[model samples]
Target: MNWILLIIAGLFEVGFATCLGKAKENSGNNAIMWYLGFLFCLTISMVLLVKVSKELPIGTAYAVWTGIGAVGSVVVGIFVFKEPATFWRVFFLSTLILSIVGLKFVSK
Candidate 1:
């Protein structure tokens, strides 16, 4: 289904973001590899988003896709990058999730 594809695309967005962060953390050959990974994932994410947008409303598709990416990226930052886990951060992320779900339900 288109929604499933959109979800996958959102995941790819997370992948690309992770790759981008990793790229900056590496050096020389590792850096190049990470950069390539970032590019590959970013391209795939964009393609999938375009496909989903073709069948779904552009605003809804973009919002949900970016919402998933934002939430996933923040979680990764906490776990992988050892970022702070403030209560307000978690609260806002939860709010974003609710909004994404609401958009899905209201969307055609």
Candidate 2:
């Protein structure tokens, strides 16, 4: 259950990050709505992350949470936001994913 919460928290991290990016691209009323939504999601994600950390080791929780968030956000940035999709960039992202998986399995 705690792992599930952690995954949800990681998803929220991606949501808030994408919202902030959209908010930055636009202006006026929509921007405000996006910013507020980002803040709300970010807060909720943090709270859930904290709860997960209590059950898992701090290092494990933080590493997995941040790794997923970072990788997920970058993927969204590439596909949704139309950022660069260079081979090197994809290679790095794959490396990060592998490292995160390794950590999840190897850590006690």
Candidate 3:
């Protein structure tokens, strides 16, 4: 389904973003490696975005895709990267999730 592809694409968005953070921690060849990984995942994300765009409304698809990426990246940041888990941050993330779900239900 297009929605499924959209979800996968969003996940890859999170993947590339995480790679970007990792790249920032390194230098020289190591950083280049991470950057390359980021680019690869980013390409996949964009490809899927374009694929789903043919079926779904671009505005809805893009908003959901980015919502997924934003929430996923924040979760990875808190858990994998040990970023702060402030209450307000979690609260806002919940709202974002709700909005994504609402979009899905309302989508034709």
Candidate with the greatest lDDT versus the true structure: 3
Report every candidate's CA lDDT.
0.94, 0.91, 0.97
What's the ranking of the predictions by TM-score, best on top? 1, 3, 2
The most accurate candidate by TM-score is 1
Residues 43-80 of candidate 2: C-alpha lDDT, one tens digit per residue:
98899999999888889889888988999999999999
Which is better, 1 or 3, measured by TM-score? 1
List runs of model 2 lying over 4 Å from the truth: none
Please give, for residues 3-100, the per-residue lDDT of candidate 1 as tens digits.
Answer: 99999999989998998899899999999998899889899999999999999999999999999999999999999999999999999999999999
Native-vs-model 2 lDDT? 0.91
How far residue 74's Cα lies from its native spot in candidate 2, in Å, is 0.8
Model 2, C-alpha of 95: deviation from truth (Å): 0.9
Residue pairs clashing, model 1: none
Worst 10 residues of 3 by lDDT: 17-26
Candidates by lDDT, descending order: 3, 1, 2
TM-score of each: 0.98, 0.94, 0.97
User: Which stretches in model 1 have alpha-carbon errors above 4 Å?
Assistant: none
